[model samples]
Target: MSRTPSFEPYEGPAGGWGSARSLGNILRREGVPASGTLVLGRQNKVDGFQCVSCAWVKPAKPLPFEFCENGAKATAWEITSHRCEPAFFAKHTVSELLGWDDYHLEQVGRLTHPMRYDAASDKYVPVSWGKAVREIGQTLRALPDRRNVVFYSSGRTSNEASYLYGLFARLYGNNNLPDSSNMCHETTSVALPPAIGVPVGTVALDDFAKTDCILFFGQNPGSNSPRMLHPMQEAAERGVPIIAYNPLRERGLERFTNPQSPTEMLTHHETKLASQYHQVKAGGDLAALTGICLAVLEMEDHAKQARLPPVLDHDFIDTHTHGFGDFLGWLRTQGWAELERRSGLSRSAMTATAEVYARSKATIGIYGMGLTQHRAGVETVQMLVNLLLMRGNIGRDGAGICPVRGHSNVQGQRTVGITEKPELVPMDRLAKQYGFEPPRETGLNTVEACEKILAREVPAFIMLGGNFVRAIPDRGQMEPAWREIGLTVNIATKLNRSQLVPGRISYILPVLGRIEQDVQNGPQSTSMEDSTGCIHGSRGVRKPASPHLISETRLVCEIAEATLESNPLTPWKDWASDYRLIRKSIGETYPEIFFDYDQRMWEPGGFQRPLPARHREWKTENGKANFITPKGLAEDKDMPEPDEDALRLITLRSNDQFNTTVYGYTDRFRGIRGTRDVVLMNRSDIARLGLSEGDRIGLRTASKRDDVRRELGGLTVVPYDIPAGCIGAYYPEANVLLPIWHYAEGSKTPAAKSVPVHVYRGPAAA
Candidate 1:
């Protein structure tokens, strides 16, 4: 058994509208005077920052208060008055700080300077920016091969920086880009390109405005992506059907009391968000989606005999799609009994959903990690596309696939070429445009990189910004694998647990945050991509928080210079100081898409990257969109049952937190105050286990042949209306129960949502 971590239980606000008020309260309670407070304005305009929470596309025109509850907390957390100056570091050693919880380590405030971990002194001492970059370059030079280096891009990176970073990595002679998306929506990336000839969302923000009905599958927009609530509110008010399907009954999906609208807030009025909510099983999404499609197919057959309009888009299928006969055959073989058992939805419920979908002129399907994080996640999304295509929903004003991303620029990063595998055309074109041959050999993804770290194959690690160590699945295995790497360099705005993983020689270099000014040696602006595939400019107005801080663009360039040594790749000699040359290179490489990127960005906001959906065009290999099929219903491996008393546990994020970092502890949405110890369980499950609502339980991983045992103890079980046979707990803490090898069958994304175990009583649970 792995040793239990010695730390306080995490207690944070459940991410939502009330989180903003809670954060403001915490700041005041902590004696950070209100007058000194800096409340950044709403998102979508100047002074308005991107919500640090989830990715909900910003409206073209700002709302009364564009910021949502979690977004407000994210802004306040970033603009907090708290600071972790040099004196604070002097008071605590790295070992001492290691004793602190993840929340305490970050809550102390932002780092003030470049720092290196001094092993002898056991504290992080400030280092100069020049020296820090030089050290990173030196480490890279020492690596036996360029392939030994792994470059990770977080979703938080702006488009311009991501472009520059990708260019630098390719120029440095490697394509080991294991990005944040791999951990979240790689399923969409892998499945979409094959199904639709695109790897990103096909829908745009304007498309939502035209959509008559939106089918939300396995998503919790209210807490996961609150900004979606605004669009959902608009659709709901317009009498559009918004059907939601998920195992858990998220309060955000039921109704939203918009804090942005004063009228609703003042009168305690709430807008009914979901037209119908279906409680599907944890891994039953694919069954539910297919069942809906089957219903539609049946309707289409009946309509044809009645001499009514063909329910299936015969014109679309014949002209712009393929594989219809094969898909139809598969649907015909599926029985209602099998569908109902796999989907956990009653036939009446399925019929209700099909009625909304069949009646709608055009419908939009939106899903989140709940669908994409599973073994059949990719196929589940493709099934939704199949249903939409039955009615010719693609290449229309109000339709297409919309995978709600968690990080802000996840989709953007993929668009700008942050990937382990780049297509031959893009790579060959890049080589032709840039003077160097791009690497042909595909590189490692998130799962592969973790294995490489464990095998001690990757010699160096460079992270733009992400709490990787904590964010990855299987904490016990990940921590040890992280320690085996030769070097780990982090370009960050603040220190995270990843910094202390002890990669032979490690450095945490401070950089400017998005809300801060980014002035190169010359005047230049940076570009970023939004969730909807819109590429725009991001200009930081405020000064860098500290004098020593540098922009990530300059730092990555310098590291490239240091690592390449005497054989520098291109005109990178001055690229660090001049960002326009970088933009110019990006345009040259992707001319058809990023044409005149520099000039176009100068206009109001920026320009949208063109897509076939926007112009109703299909760019598939067969000259038409394809109907894809799944090998199976789902892919989570069933574990052997433990003793009757044991329970399986899964982890999730709270409202006051993003990934692993905590801003404060108070889950207002669940009505639990000052605690992360509360476990969400079905009332029936509680009864079945002979446990009361407030009973304490110990969660243990089912025994395996490998002898790797995980137990998370001292959890307070609070009966919730969650789907039966499933449980929800906060992450990093519960991450221990997830096995590294227990991930998606093809995508390799850790199944953080469905780990099977035994929940029982006592300190043994801990």
Candidate 2:
């Protein structure tokens, strides 16, 4: 291939990279030879630090070489030999660094000093730990109300850190802990609890081993979570039908060449995944899932009329569910035409999928952004729960609603009560455990937090770990919103857009990465939950990047103590001086599952948390899963009407990427190289527009802006394997196309995956 791609001088947002191959390509471009020593001590290990890439499920029985292509890159990115120490920062001012691309900044390597943005010279000057803490605390205190401050947590934060961070926020009299979840799976959180009592995934790792079939929707496991490909490969081998519902024909969904399969590798063979692949359009999952559920219910009726056993699990449904009659009535109202049209699938395809689902002894329906970024996002998830409930799939082995997460510890962060609205039970328990009155009032979510900052209603912001500005939609609004804050503190390991956007005073506190040593008051290990619901312990074999770098647990405790007037005990203070106390706090607050967390983490593989649904129990308010009837199909009014020159533009990830952090520019699977400017267009639509491959174009949103004429124009176009009426662009860049008001109903997550816009031949007039 063209000499492996490397980092270039990208002049876009901070903390962003587009392609995976860029790293190698950039290094080669810079004439930096690949460090052979850097590749050592990274392979052939189980029970090592987990991949910090996408939230893919890992192997329960750790394989000798279990990592995927993305996983290896994620690890290398974190543990690279390159270092951006204090000397490096001194060479360039914040403004000069800002001129560099996201890829260039990260490729320079790890941040070795705590730096604060000095606005005078527009440079990042080193600051003492004492000054950093006091600055942040003073800003929080200066806020009109504690509610003015927001604590945004990334999925990369350890469970111990998340717990301490939430406790600090609550003790400080606010619950505005808008996490990454609000952007990805808030639909599951808001809708699932109402329908099934649990807002998270109901299936466990063991459930995958037991289930007869796996039904995947709106999720691309290959790029999102390559680790899941293994379990899928296993299920496929066991004769379990693995069905995929997606708009694009994903290679990850097709046959996979297992890097760990020695036999297959030698023979140059591969295993086929996704026995059945259905190409559903954007926002078509609800119709597809609804059709399948309705067909299953109809087949049951036919079987009963024929004096055969009902296709539905009537016994399980009778005992553990409500609203069956209403669901049946609603099913009758949705005709085959609506199902076929909405789902972009033929009626026969729907019938065939329903047949496979009915024949299976148990099934698990897994989904992600595809379903969550729609106007009917919440209802779509509820319907999936209903589908599982009808088959008694949930509370049974291997069958239930599994909302896959994007970040590694994102779900666990929520589980530890990192939320805008903390549950009463968890809050009361936290107060009792920490000797402080936790906040009862609901706080601001992501969208609301940005609004507060924009309105000058918020004075300060502290992010645990995440590229908040780039990650959040409406970058136009978000960039200016940061300036309104009196102080902004980001507890991060590296520099990103969040670091560059300054308040009156801004501090970027360097912290330890997950793969680094986490030394506390005493010897202890931290644990996290994999996307597939497996809890595992993580211990770093490598030393901390710097002795100056502290664990997130220590940093949060210090800040909480500095900012709080209530004399809240520094939970991580004593714990940092030992990690066992942190584990004890986790066990105390969530004893049911985290019981003996300290001891359990030490156990070889770590212990699994109890998923009641795995045993066929519904935790809904009614003590049963209720089948929800969706209101009706809704369209993206943002798109120009059918006759208008509008095509839906959805954002996607390259194999080398994980969320906003791009490892490289080239997409190996898509055959695109050396560019993030390429847009994946439907072949037919591009042909109709008289556009060819590699054509430079501008993409304008159908919904014009009233305040500013902002549009995601001037992008390169490339025909990809995607459906008609659909186009694809990378996030944060495409984020400009997503208006602040354009969000999923109820969940408030921007429809980053599905946007409608018009394509032009060249850049719009600037």
Candidate 3:
């Protein structure tokens, strides 16, 4: 357990000495001090493994130390000297390990061998790979309906492995493939295709160089993607205006001092990032964005009256888009007073931001989960698209919609057919090439899968690389439901909370990490797609943590081989032994996208998958970009106005964490030390709630449903510079308060950002 946390204001910039010191401390703690630098030196290089962190775009020209603090921690965490062997499990039972925190569980180090749960002893025992695969195959084969099985993939998986995993699920007769994207950027994938003709971001790494302005929304680059700060700093230094709109003023958007810069490091000089920062209310992004567009239209109308040049891009709208007149008509109907009340921003600020967008020749719109993890996630993204469409930002150099994805290959996983919706991929081609009937019926997504599991409908669950139990919402209900499932299989490198909450029959299959060499056929390489739509090869340099570990591809192929009847056309053995064969098959599957896959992936910066949106070609039903209008300003149309006692909860990650993996107890950027169980509230809200800083508070979900009681207690209150009526808490801990049924309407992403809750003094409060 961690010590009690202490709060203080962070006075320094985002990076520089603080980041460097943090990295050094993590290395020393992981017992890789000297060798860690050597490992990090190879990260993100052409001939090296990709960083297993955020899917930030890698530059065409590389730097010597391209890895950031989070990347280094991920690498060190994977390459740690400590090991979780069979002997360790012999001493501690699953129930005992369940009491350990997430950080301590992962800190126990990498799993050395495949293990099977012995329910009698409540402990895991080492199992032979052959026996484990055979038994798992028997269980899967015994299932009455293939749709009852769920195959979940993580963003850390490579494209090749993800493709095989998807193919295996389909061949076994279902498309129930729910990946990490379902929880994060599914909104972007579902919303962008209709507007931009692509599911991924349109901008490349080089776009930042030519962009004259940047519109940043809801993403904190300092903790989530540190490497993004380097380019942001460069753009800041080049006089490019960066407009940031978020509920909290993140340190990364405020100012930054690049740790790689010697002069700045020595002088302690900081570069201001966001020229203008607007702290919009949580769940108010739709209203805020609508206000900006309305302000832009007002500016255009005023320009016409003054006989000045038109503010709208008439040529682009006339030539390549539809529904403009309707959009214009709706903008005129919106009232400014309502917009201000909902958005928590004054009209002058909206108009000023509109002026910035109208004056700049090119502007890139960037956003993250803050806009996605809401009830109006899809609409919010479409509104961002609406803003870009007005200015002809799509399909233009240095200007486009960029969704900063979380996991490294999340976008890549979708690209490789890891989706619950079969129509998203070329199912006919896959059926023809592999000689198997593909499942045409839509499959369950992450939330839907959980619903089925809770209903006792799911028979088996196979996880590729994530802590599913911990990552999902409504954990109090899900954990017990997860244990009730017939079988659960986890393929991972380290021990996580998901593994401890085992099913009736469970197996923990240890796999090689990204930094470990896979020697299936003399050494193998895997490909991953970055957030910018670039496909590159990653070859692991270090040896496996244990000789007992196997490659993810091999493990997936072996399971497929054991479960399904042998097919001459599939040739699972060939693909398992040589990844090039898998690439060749993928090339055949997506000839237009992955042509000459093996050879091109080895190029200096690899190659970019073609994005039709980048070339002014819309793949919509009418072959033109369409303007989408959201129904209302409130993200959740059904959400009743909160009472005076209610506050909107926004779940966020700390600097010492990535997704659900906790590295330590310190949130360096927020000046939170030694604890993760705390709530950041506006000073006014704190006072209004009759609470002071350091007061222990309890929060209960303000849900209409009466069946479940979701509450978190003993949380220390820390006054923060956030908007009133909004409070922030760390995710996974706060995920319990998010109702499982409350999610985005179209995308089905859990509405974690705008959960309504009531706060009060805890029993321990003085």
Residue 204 of candidate 1: its Cα lDDT? Answer: 79
lDDT of each: 0.74, 0.74, 0.91
lDDT of 1 at 471: 85
- TM per candidate comes to 0.93, 0.92, 0.99
Off by over 4 Å in 3: 763-766
Candidate 3 lDDT over 231-252, as tens digits, reads 8999999999999999998999
Cα lDDT tens digits, model 1, 1-766, are 1222222322222223354466567556444435314434434553334554566666556665666666655555555566777777677887667666777777777667888877777777788878888878776777668885899988888666787788778877788888888888888877777677777778878877899989988777666677777777788889988999987777777777666566766676677878899988777789998899888888888998998987777988887788898999999988888788777788778878998899988888888888787767778878888888888888788988888888877877777788888672388877767667788788888888887887878888889998888788777777877777878887776667888776777788878777666677755557666678766565555555687778888787777777663543356656677777778877777787788877775444346787775454666677678898777664454555323454435467765677676766655566555667667888788998988877878787775545777777888888776777778888877877777776666677776766777876875543
Best by lDDT: 3
**Where does model 1 exceed 4 Å of error?**
1-20, 26-39, 46-53, 522-524, 565-569, 602-605, 637-650, 703-706, 764-766
Model 3 lDDT on a 0 to 1 scale: 0.91
Put down candidate 2 lDDT per residue, 638-725, tens digits, no spaces. Answer: 4444333777777788765788777776566666657676678787988888998768898776674344444766677777778787
Ranking by TM-score: 3, 1, 2
What is the model-wide C-alpha lDDT for candidate 2?
Answer: 0.74
When sorted by lDDT, best at the front, the candidate numbers are 3, 2, 1
Poorly placed runs, candidate 2 (over 4 Å): 1-47, 58-60, 520-524, 566-572, 635-644, 704-708, 764-766
The candidate that achieves the highest TM-score relative to the unseen native structure? 3
